[model samples]
Target: QFDQTIDYWGGRPHDDAWRAAAEQRIAELRTAPLTIRVNGALGAPVPGATVRVEQVRHHFRFGTAAPAGRFVGTDADSERFRAEVARLYNTVTFENDLKWHDVNPAEQQRIDAAIDWLDEHEITLRGHVLVWNFEVMPPRVRDLDAEAMRAAVHQRVTDQVGLYRDRLYLWDVVNEAVTNTEIWDRIGWDQFPEVFRLARAAGPNIGLAYNEYNMLNDREGHWRRSLENARRLIDAGAPITTFGEQAHQGVPLVPLPRVLELLDEAAKLGLRIEITEFDLGGVDDEEVHAQYVADFMTACFSHPSVDAFILWGFWEGSHWRAGENAAMFRRDWSKKPAQDAWEDLVLNQWWTRAAGETDGAGEFTQPVFYGRHRVTVEHDGQTVQAIVERTPDSPDWVMVSLP
Candidate 1:
């Protein structure tokens, strides 16, 4: 109801009388700031001149999910883990808090602390797995008959999702259920869409996602059921916003061409394709891991459909999967080859920084990433500075002159 009422994209124009009156009032008061013209030059000092303003940092969020239990500590024996996380990722997903069995008293403390850190940093949050029966289930709910389980599902959705209502931008409405009958086995496959519907109702504008693994290597029948399941949920009026594939690879990591092919197919769904749980493991050689990470991340980011590439966890100490091959970071907090590869792409290659001659009218334009930037204009050996905000809605040019 709220989204419909406050439709930002296609909402009706402002009331004509209100707009006319506002324009009239604005015209009556001419207090708008005028441009400061520097006398160094009559026009752009450089021929074919244009001022260049490029967003060096991407607004696109790079994120990861981790266990909250790793965050609680104040002694010499314990380290400030969340502080380390604050240095890298811009978004976070609680690895355990959103699950049913893990929402106990002890876990709640950790969950609260994680939320505080996220809020303090103003980081985006994705709530994972509202009703994932395969991963972990409350024992009581698991053993119940169909009717009791049905009630339990709805109740849990309401309880947990409702707790973070209007806060989480996305939620894994039903996880890995498309691959099996865990959820539909109890609720009936015909009513499987109910989980998504309940989640949409529980979390209003939150993105209800259908997250599953093996969607990429679906040369077999791996993706058939999941694809059809997504169709069913969409047709049934479930406000599914994003589709996720847990990209965890071992010995046989997904081929780059195959992953790109899957990305094309996922784009057909008309939703954001999130590589939610991405990890390239099962290789002892860090160089191999680094190359694989480079290829995998390049494929995902290059594709137009893919939105985010969130690693499962960064450090081996906090990683749920155990192995030298697993996770992006080593035990001593040193960057692995894989981490270096990813950082190089995001920070060096993708980072937009450019120097160019300003065009006539003392303006420069370039399509760069969306973020904050500082534009410096040089004319006649004097420099003038102005802040440039590159955003999606308004990303074009920055104007500057000598003061």
Candidate 2:
């Protein structure tokens, strides 16, 4: 009697039936990981990466996770990286820390590796910089004479551009060239034209951008100088296609309207635009910061002329500006409130899903909408929201929208 009672409690018919059904359903729903594909190329898969899909809720709240899978598409290492990004972000940008010195230190292998990684994962790669007056150039090149420097610049640009000509789409052709006039004076501003010229010659189809900081501050003189330089480059037939503003506001205090105004003016130039490096730091209010990020992305994405927006680094642990937690992820790879805010406002609410419908003349109309519409889409069985708006003739989507 005692043995029979123990068996009944441990393995009752009712409990065993329910457990078997649940296990069967779980096994049936499981997939062998999703592959990352970009432009018809298979991207590397990630393993052990958690992919969470949530719905967009009212007032910037993201819904709970629905369904997710691990990475199993490529080599083990590549798979790991891809899984990492897929778990946290739908979009990823390649960084250039190793490119400036390490890759070209003596050869292009390092640059090639970085490019290969992006290609393998089907990640959108932004050539961090073709020219920056500081922080990028090695001391060896800095010490070169004027002629040698020009030659060096020409070689570097040509080689780099030629190597990644068709692979990379956007480039920061001349970074911070205006911020420090003394450096230009020392290196000879004339060399700047050559840099642009060589890059165009090497990769004419790629988008070339001039990047700088503090333009949003509305410093009239500085703004004028940067614009003038851009105009000169454009007028000279340089492939100056985009204006990249490094919108790293040290504090979360930039005026939203002012930010819009700057973007509007850039549109007038008829060039593609990007908020190349954006980070709003020094604020502890997660809600406010999330709103600020959403608002900023909305304004940029709403503009037809703006193309793509890149968060400098999504994880605080890997961010260059360490002390400040400006990324969407905390140090431990967990999602910060800002991450949810961005995903809700930019991906779910702002992005348009492919709906089946023909707008006119039997042409299938894509789900994309124009002029600041809140987007709601299902990812991983969860609903998310983002604000997306664009005018005709704008090249890329800006992810700046406020709730």
Candidate 3:
């Protein structure tokens, strides 16, 4: 694999300056000053109280594409798969179970079970897609005539989006529309907007995403075509709430500067940008993959419009392309360099876990990552803990009253 991809994408920059700049930007954009105020029942200050602020979940989604069969199965590898997902990701997109081709009674049952597990574990699930004109389409759909094709598209949107309405965080209403235009070609260009309208009607609260590939990695004519199509859909009344980039990269990786520039271009659409399906392929060197992963993540996080970072797959056992060479972990679950880099950033550097004592004003102030946190305060042998969240709109101070 290494020899094959040696000259594939091109030479990646070995400089650290761009990454350093991105990290600095992360410290500015991804965190905010938080003041945890401790007070008694009667509003008296509880100075000197011990306080611990541990982040519970990120407001920024970190996730992977998970296979429903493995997620809901009762085997050892299945157990490992479930455990790894829950431990590592706060969200997941169903790999194929929710797609048009794979949709079946058996798959639906597995999806239902997986939904239950995700809810129980407090993990958010994203519907992979409501419509795709590519390989995942139902076999005979392409052969249908205009009326039948229109009905098929509507039914597909209604069934999946309606079934998982409030359960999913987002849905790829129309995927890969730039290059894959069979749906629109058959039903007419207006059909594109109608599918989004149907999805919105079925699941009004769930975010609708316009997803595509190559826009970020290659960034040639594909990028312009995708952006133009997105504008066309929006102008025709499609309610696209987010832009999803399947940032699957080959060698001669997209540079850090280009990565940031592409994000800026997507941000011009005025919708949140999500790194929907991120993974580096073709390169067999674990170190190369790890560094690029870190660089890409830093670039995304530094951009204000980017909201989520989700891998196409995490385990080599379950990856779609390049198998063992394209994922963070090997098939045997060994720690690959990519896995270490991901954990080091997600679990350590970017995570917030601070401990301190309140001041004379009963306030313990700390700069923290923007996310949900569990705050525990101990005063005079009484312990009080509460779940708190910090966002751009949230107040800097959170008050916790003692018993």
Candidate 4:
């Protein structure tokens, strides 16, 4: 057994017989420790060997939703929201926190606190919405004509992005613009380019997303229209980075196959996919809901284009849907069946941990997620600390020095 297992072969050649012997010798490394010496020319394997691999940052993003301040609560509620959100999720979208209709100084204060905490902890934040219609739209804008409305929209986009430009992880540049709402009809559906354009101008590096619901049910080709809208934004030169599927798959949802099929459609738009607002409401069966969450999340993770998945609300105490407790956490801050199910998958099953000691020719290799990893190598009384980043775009065989 040894440390600093990099390349000991140092470009040595071997014949078929030698290769066979090396394969047999390496196979034994899986069960026990081994050591070997390199000829520096023949590349001969003398005996025992092992390889270790680690991931630094994974490509997948698993997250959940929360409301404003324990709903912006005082003590217990605030602490629960703060601690639990950090415990489980890596990304979050304010349930109704940062919307335009409910913007207030106090609410903004609560929001500032949340974003600050997330930033300090290196968590991701998603802006719920930027451009919307129907009641949520400002009352002052109703009377504005097409040109004025466009100007108002631009101003709104510019102002919001400017305010949170540094802390924004992703922006819902436009939300549900495919509705039959007359306000959108007045301003021109094609104006999303302007809305998306403003967001990019203010926060050039922020991820801009077009988020919409009902894409799971297809709902009269609204999903198709949503994709078309995304493309239109791109055509108009808006930096649209993700297609958000608000996977509100109804109370008693359809089979997982159909759910995956719907997710696949959004993925085809050539943009990254995010299951932005997910909630298993309507049906109250906890057992079924837990299974649905696990299955649904698995489907989303299986897709190559899908990267971020978020639940709308995960606690009965603060769920947006009144009286309906379609949450993964109980009101008393206890873990529900669904919570355990999702956690079991994201934090346990797919989580990687492996160890191996190197042969005389130093080399350790293992399959791990693409991310930054803290690597520790030890032998005898010596210890080595290394920061290794395993990225999909990066090649294998990282060299770590040991003292």
Order the numbered candidates by TM-score, best leading: 3, 4, 1, 2
- What lDDT tens digits, residue by residue, belong to model 1 across residues 83-146? 6666666777878767777466777777788677677776778888777774478776788888
Which residues of candidate 3, in runs, are more than 4 Å off? 1-14
Clashes of each: 8, 36, 3, 18
Root-mean-square deviation per candidate: 13.9, 18.3, 2.6, 12.7
Shift in Å, residue 41, candidate 3: 4.0
What residue runs in model 2 are displaced by over 4 Å at the alpha carbon?
1-81, 87-93, 102-111, 353-403
Write model 3 residue lDDT over 1-403, tens digit each, in one string.
Answer: 1344465446655345677778888899999999999999999988999999998888789999988887778988789988998888999998878888745687678789989999999999988888887467777886888899899889889988888897999998889988788778878988888888999999989999999999787567999899888888778878889989989887677777888888888889888889999988876777777877877788898898988999999887788974637888888888789899898888889999999999999999999999889999998899999998998789988999998
Error at 380, model 3, angstroms: 3.2
Tens digits of per-residue lDDT, candidate 2, 263-313, equal 777677778777777777765666666766776666665555655666776
Error of 4 at 136 (Å): 1.6
- Show the colliding residue pairs in model 3: 9-251, 9-252, 10-252
Estimate the overall C-alpha local distance difference test score of candidate 4.
0.68
Q: Model-by-model lDDT, in order?
A: 0.68, 0.56, 0.86, 0.68
TM-score of 2: 0.66
Q: CA shift at 172, candidate 2, in angstroms?
A: 1.0
